[model samples]
Target: MERERESVSAMFGAVPEAAGMARDVLREALEKWEVRKGADDAALVLTELVTNAIRHGTTISVRVVRERDDALRLEVADGSRDLPRPRTASTEDEDGRGMLIVTALALDWGVRPFLGGKTVFALLKVG
Candidate 1:
């Protein structure tokens, strides 16, 4: 049987609750699609993306696209023109490892500049 494809987009304010709300939306989408085996990772990615947006940008938005070829793409956009760089972590630091994890796990990932901001995206293979 062929897999299904789905897409969703949301906008959020620069607040702490945004991340949790994004996670909830993603979880609900995954459940509705009957997607499994990467929901946790996806949720974590959502949190990282949303948190970064809230910290660095004036507004945040999330877009999730599930492809018929069993690929899922997660994108987070914010009103910041800066591009994301994956940094090497030190044991003493409590943060700065989210993108690294996403890079390690995602099939493909990149950043693109938009009208007033940039969108960071990660693609995963979901069956």
Candidate 2:
């Protein structure tokens, strides 16, 4: 038997507002797929990923996928080949905490090289 799956994707401009926009879209998509358990965590992760992409790339694309067991996967693709480095941030730092939050929340997360840039993905075991 095969597991059922649902996916939603979109592209957003490389602007400050993109993160909020991505969160809205992700929330809608997750709700449609009945993924409520990890929705808040997913939103936080999405905000971090989308914000990082906007800071480094010109165009960003977001993707969310849900499996039959309710595990959720979120990805943010940017138009830059620069790889993501997860690092610890100091309390005084104004930024550089995105990946830290992602690392703490995601079941697993990594990057994959794509055509123009790379895709950073986080998986959450919602089930």
For each candidate, give its TM-score against the true structure. Answer: 0.92, 0.92
Q: Which stretches of candidate 1 lie over 4 Å from their true place?
A: none
Candidate 1, 1-127: lDDT as tens digits? 7765679888989899999989988988888888887888888877887887888848788998987647889999999998877898899999889888888778888999988899999888775
Decoy 2 TM-score against native: 0.92
Pick by lDDT: which candidate is best? 2
The Cα error of candidate 2 at residue 98, in Å, is 0.9
Off by over 4 Å in 2: 1-3
lDDT of each: 0.85, 0.88
